[model samples]
Every structure is written in C-alpha cells, then in structure tokens.
Target: MATRFLIEGRVQGVGYRNWLQEEARRRGLRGTVRNLSDGRVEAVIIGSYEETDAMLAACRKGPPLAKVSGIGLDPIDDPDVSGFIVLRDY
Candidate 1:
C-alpha cells in the first residue's frame, strides 16, 4: 500500500522536503515530497509498513528549522512509487 501525508505548519523554506528526501532514501522509501502553496509539505512514500511508520515519525520532528504542527495521512490505491524527488513548488 502507498501512504500519502500532508504536513502543515512551518514547513516551507526550512529544508523540510530535502531532509525528508534524505531520510526516506536512508530508509529505502520511494516517493516524492513537495511544498504546497498553503504552507504545507506533502509527501507520498511507498515502502514497507515499518519503513513508512519510521518516515512518519521523522516527519513529526522534521528538520531543525521546521515547526511541524500537523500531519494528515491518506492511503492511496496506486502501486508503489519509483524514486524519491523534491517536486517543484505548488
């Protein structure tokens, strides 16, 4: 199963996506993370249940500059994603 997350708070301009990319890679996850115009960071990570859980845990703290306030999870029907990328700002 694929898991998508919408993280709201002080996420943009804080290297949150970049940090997430690194951490996701470290955990061998496949997905993308991007910034939303509504001042949120969104990510879709496809991996084992344990790895996805770890990714969510990391998202709670985020980078040193990020002040994460909330995280919303949604399970998607799509197949596992490919590589991880920092998508263009939305």
Candidate 2:
C-alpha cells in the first residue's frame, strides 16, 4: 500500500526528513520525504498495512526537534518509489 502524508507544524528545519528516511528504512518500507515550501513536510510512503500504520504513528512524533501539530493522510496508488529517500525541499 502507498499513501501521502502532510505533516504540519514545526516540521521544517527540524531533521524530520532524515528521521522519516531512517524510520521507513528501519521498518523496511520504501518512500520519499521532503520539506514543503509551505513549511510542512510531505512524505510518500509505501509498505505493508502494518508497516505503513506504524510509519504513521512514528511520523506523529517525528524527530526530537519537530513539534508536529497535525497530519493529513491521503491514500494513493503510486508505488514506484524505492528504498527511502530524503528528497530536496519541494
């Protein structure tokens, strides 16, 4: 399964992208994460049901410096991603 996550609040410049890459890799998931121009963090994640669910849970807290205020989830059919990447800001 694949999904997109829009993480808001204190996410930018907080190591959230690196944290996401590490978390997804640790969970054996594939995806990409980037800092959005609107000061949010966007992540495209692909994995099994359990892993994706776990990933969402982890994203809620993010890295130590991140103060996640909210998260928006959007289910998608794109699964072309591989490994986990911390993409350049978008």
Candidate 3:
C-alpha cells in the first residue's frame, strides 16, 4: 500500500525530511520524503498496512525540532517503490 503525507508546521528548516527518512528506513518502509516549496514536508510511504500506520504515527510527532501542526494523509494508487530515499525539494 502507498500513502502520501503532507506534514506542516515548522517542518521546512528543521531537518524533517532527513529525520523522516531515518524513521522510514528504521521501519523497513520503502518510498521517498521531500520538502515542498510551500514549507511543508511530503513523504510517500509504501509498505504493509501496519508499517504505513506506524510511519504516520511518527510523522504526527516528527523530529524534536518540528512543531507538526497538521498531517494530511492521502491514499495513493501508485506502484510500489524500493528503498527509502531523501528526494530533492519539491
């Protein structure tokens, strides 16, 4: 399964993407995380239901520096991706 997360609030300059990458990798999830031009962080997580849910939970808290006011989740019908990656800013 694949889900896209748009994380907002103090996420842009707080190493949110890198931190999310580590979290995803630690959970054995495969996909990408990037910073959006609008100051939010975006992550595409592809994994089992449990893994995806776990990632979403972590995103709610985010890194220590991130305020994480809101997290927007969208179900995606995309092909599965391999490995977790830190993508260029979107």
Which candidate ranks first by lDDT, i.e. highest? 1
Off by over 4 Å in 1: none
| Alpha-carbon local distance difference test for all models | 0.90, 0.90, 0.89
Model 3 residue 84 CA deviation (Å) reads 0.5
lDDT tens digits, residue span 42-62, model 2: 999998888889899999998
lDDT of 2 at 8: 98
Where does model 3 exceed 4 Å of error? none
> Which candidate has the highest TM-score of all?
2
- State the lDDT of candidate 3 residue by residue for 1-90, as single tens digits: 899999889998888888999999988889998888999888999998999998889899988988999989999986567799988886
TM per candidate comes to: 0.94, 0.95, 0.93
- Pick by lDDT: 1 or 3, better one: 1
Candidate 1: give the clashing pairs. Answer: none
Each prediction's RMSD to truth: 1.1, 0.9, 1.0
**Whole-model lDDT for model 2 versus the true structure?**
0.90
Residues 54-86, candidate 1: write the lDDT tens digits: 899999999999999999999987555678888
Ranking by lDDT: 1, 2, 3
Which pairs clash in the backbone of model 2?
A: none
